[model samples]
Target: MFLVGLTGGIATGKSTVSCMVKDMGVPVVDADLIARQIVEPGRRAWKKIREVFGDEVFLDSGEIDRPKLGAIVFSDIEKRRALNKITHPDIYSEIRGQVFKHFLRGEQFVVLDLPLLYESNRVSSYLYKTIVVSCDDELQLERLLERNQFTEKEAIARIEAQMPLDRKCQLADIIIENSGSIAETRKQVEGIIKLLRSSNHHIYNRVFYGGIFIVVLTAIAMLMYWIFMR
Candidate 1:
């Protein structure tokens, strides 16, 4: 399957575009959802977090106190990297598993909805293309403040923590300008879906990988036969 990486700055409407793609019948492996899941109460990441950050970051019910953790990491770059180190491996593992499941089901393309697709670059090598959803910086700050109820300072800190939207757009194969109306964003998404569907890259990938598999099997068989003959 052709893997497309979808990313954007915080509050840049990346989620909106991701939903549009999903609603249009494309498979999306959501990294944010996977990140939440991997850090649940007793998961490996949860235990590591508990060990590293101590009991303060957890609630009485044993769930990670996400807001508390977010406050820490967003304010401190070291803390954020420490958190990423703990959770990223598990997140990527789950993402890969989901992508493989979709590929096995013969999906032509799958979108990986990642917030830090460029920052981490962990899965960039596997992507057939990348789409970055972006908007004006001021609008992004306003949306984040309203949606997250964070003070302007807190919101700006979180935004500054990420790679800039302009840089992301520069690296993107396709850029969806989300500074306009929802209708405009939807139109762009539709065009992107049409472009992806028309590419038919998945067929070529499958054939290429299948040929390699066959070649390996044939080589192993020939080696076994020669040993037996000897």
Candidate 2:
């Protein structure tokens, strides 16, 4: 099975595309979901975060106050890096496991929904293809404001914190322009799905592994024949 990496800037409709893919019965290993799971109340990542950021970032219910933590990290590069350092390893480990499960299930391809696919840059090398979902900056800003209820300054800061959408598009094997209507976006996603389904990566991998298995079996038979002759 081959792996596809799906990414986009904040509020660029990556999640929307991800949901579309999921609805189509494609396996998607979502890193954002894994990140949240890893940091749940008493998880190792949660413990590390509480240790580093202190009790202030936790709510009265002992859950991490995401907004409070986000406010802290988004403004400070070092703190952001520290947070990533604490959580990333766990997140990646879980993502890898999920991908492996899909592979064992003999999926044709799996999509990894990673918000930081470009920024992290670690998993891209393993992906058969990378897709970037993007919109115009104005539309992106407008969406962020509406969805997150953030002031213009806060929305812009959040947008500026990640790798630029243009740079991500430049790196992508496919670009889904989400600035248009939902139907237009769905059409783009369907086209991408068809393209990925038609790919020869999975076929090539099966052929390659089958050849290796045959070679190993032949070598074993030859060794057994030699032993019998002796």
Candidate 3:
């Protein structure tokens, strides 16, 4: 599978580009979704966090108080690393599983949507290109304020928590400037996908022939218990 790493700073329209890519029927493995799944009330991560940080981090509904926890973690690098130490492995495991599933399905291309792609060191080596959606700091601040109802300072805090956009863009294989309209951004995504479909022969071969082995193994794993139990 051709696996592209997608990333951008907070509120820089990464979500918009990801959605558009999905809307156009490309398979996307969203790290954010996986992160959320791993942190739900009864999940191992949640239980561990509760044990470590105690009850004050939970709400009346017995769920982790994300905002409260975020406040503490974001302000301190050690705490931030501690939180990531708890969550990143689980999320990465989930991501690997999903990508393998997509590969087994004979998919020619897939996107790994990770917000902290560069910050997390996920972009250093990849099977496919890395794409960074970016906007200027001022525009990012404005868009974040409008989208999340965050004050300018609040948005800046979140943005500051990430590496600078310019640095991220410099690392990207493809820099998608998302400061423009939806049409412009979508056009860029569309053009990139179209070129990739025509240009990537290795991916075409993997999907056409090698993927059958993957699919058969996945099927065996999924159905083995049913067959053996009977």
Query: TM-score of every model?
Result: 0.96, 0.91, 0.86
Estimate the lDDT of model 1.
0.95
Best by TM-score: 1
User: Which candidate, 2 or 3, has the higher lDDT?
Assistant: 2
Sorted on TM-score, best first, the list reads: 1, 2, 3
Summarize candidate 2's per-residue lDDT along 108-188 as a digit string, tens digits: 999999999989888988889999999999999999999999889889889999999999999999999999999999999
Off by over 4 Å in 1: 226-230
lDDT by residue (1-230, candidate 1, tens digit) is: 78999999999999999999999999999999999999898899999999999999999999999899999999999989999999999998999899889988999999999999999999899899999999999999999999999999999999999999999999999999999999999999999999999997898899999999999999999999999988
Model 2 residue 106 lDDT?
Answer: 92
- Candidate with more favorable, higher TM-score: 1 or 2: 1
What candidate 3 gets wrong by more than 4 Å, as runs, is 204-230
State the C-alpha lDDT per candidate.
Answer: 0.95, 0.94, 0.85
Best by lDDT: 1
